[model samples]
Target: MRRSFRVLLCLAATAVGLTTLSAPANAAAHNYVALGDSYSSGVGTGGTYSGGGCKRSTNAYPQLWANTHAPASFNFAACSGATTTDVLNSQLGSLTARTTLVTISIGGNDAGFVDVITTCTLGSDSTCVNRVEQGKTFARNTLPARLDNVYSAIRQRSPSARVVVLGYPRFYKVPGSCNVGLSDTKRSAINSGADVLAQVTAQRAAAAGFTFVDIRGAWTGHEICSGDWWLNSLTWPVEESYHPNKNGQARGYLPALNAVTG
Candidate 1:
């Protein structure tokens, strides 16, 4: 009958409308926020990111990923001197309901690992090794709890966000050439320090149901002392500077972007 035909047509129209409605939500563009330390801030990499005046650079990994992938909205709250608490308190505020991706690199400063490196360079003896080892142990024990809190705070702030915790790259190669005293053995210890810290960070992020992007292997050929190094080849106030040059950042961070966006 005509009445039956009308009801069938109405149902089909409603189904089509429902499909159309669901499509947009499913296809909704993503919002991204990046939070972390100097490496994440893109300090030496030297390009101006959005909110450039905040001191974050355009070539920073977050901006790179956003520009390469074209997210719907982007926030780069990564500051040069950020720590774990800094990320949870200051950077977490930048995240919102629309944020689909959140990335961070933290805990190196928390462990005061940089100071240990400086001290080791000042003198190479059992005393120096002991001090560095002590710092490493402390970082291994204490950093995870703080990172856990950071992840928890982030998830609470943006439940829909895919949080990615990035590990720091190995600054020195097998035999760092920064100083004459930096022997192969000493350099190994430094690499070990970075490896431990990175693994701990990744493990903590994984425990919180977030993704952890390890960039150590990705940056194998581009370490600090390597020719055309991505990281600075020497310490501050020293030779060629030890942070990532533009090439280093591109090599160091691109794999992370690929892993994350894929």
Candidate 2:
């Protein structure tokens, strides 16, 4: 009876070892390429950056996903302040026929988000409102064609890639509890512009047959005005301002990407 019991244990252990050894062989190895602007590059996350001045942080969603998923190859091609043209000219070179996945967030900069924020921060209520309207107009009228160009290029280069197009979050929470920042009017206008950008980007992405992830809903109660801010508020060094913080990348964007990727 003792010998039989020992043989059973050995057999079970051997089976478990074989299962462990085979798991890696069955795991799919994906070729992933990340592209976009500051949001995708992770400017406000405050970790080490690569790709020269691209500011691609270790905490960014792409890196974080790669760390966990162990894709066959990860090309972090995203750059700070990248416009749609920038992606078309510079970023798409990393993507190829073998690229299994691609993720990006763009169009905000093309719509002049940085200038809008700067004007809203320093100028009077009227200036802020007007600037926000102009941004909305640009997003609605001009951004679709630019987005079409980028999406078309992505589809052309990486024909089989599962492309995930992420949109910007609303920068502020209107009627928020915070008292020290700009008036509710400015905050509301900023959100309206963000909505326009999201709408236009979503339409274009869908037309291109890509998955569109609207981060605005995921980032609710965590904008610049919230007590627990996922986005920075009028930060110094200029680039970090209006960008997402670490939690925003890890908790917010990461999960949003994971939901679709998984």
* lDDT (Cα atoms) of all candidates against the true structure: 0.75, 0.90
Candidate 1: which stretches are off by over 4 Å? 1-28, 47-54, 176-181, 235-241
Instruction: State the lDDT of candidate 1 residue by residue for 115-152, as single tens digits.
Output: 76777677775656776687679778888899888888
The collision pairs in model 1 are: 47-58, 48-58, 49-57, 49-58, 230-248, 232-241, 232-242, 232-243
State model 2's lDDT. 0.90
Q: Pick the candidate with the highest TM-score.
A: 2
Any idea how many clashes model 1 has?
A: 8
lDDT of 1: 0.75
Those runs of model 2 whose alpha carbons end farther than 4 Å from true positions after fitting are 1-28
Q: Per-residue alpha-carbon lDDT of model 2 for 119-158, expressed as tens digits? A: 9888988999999899888888888999999999999999
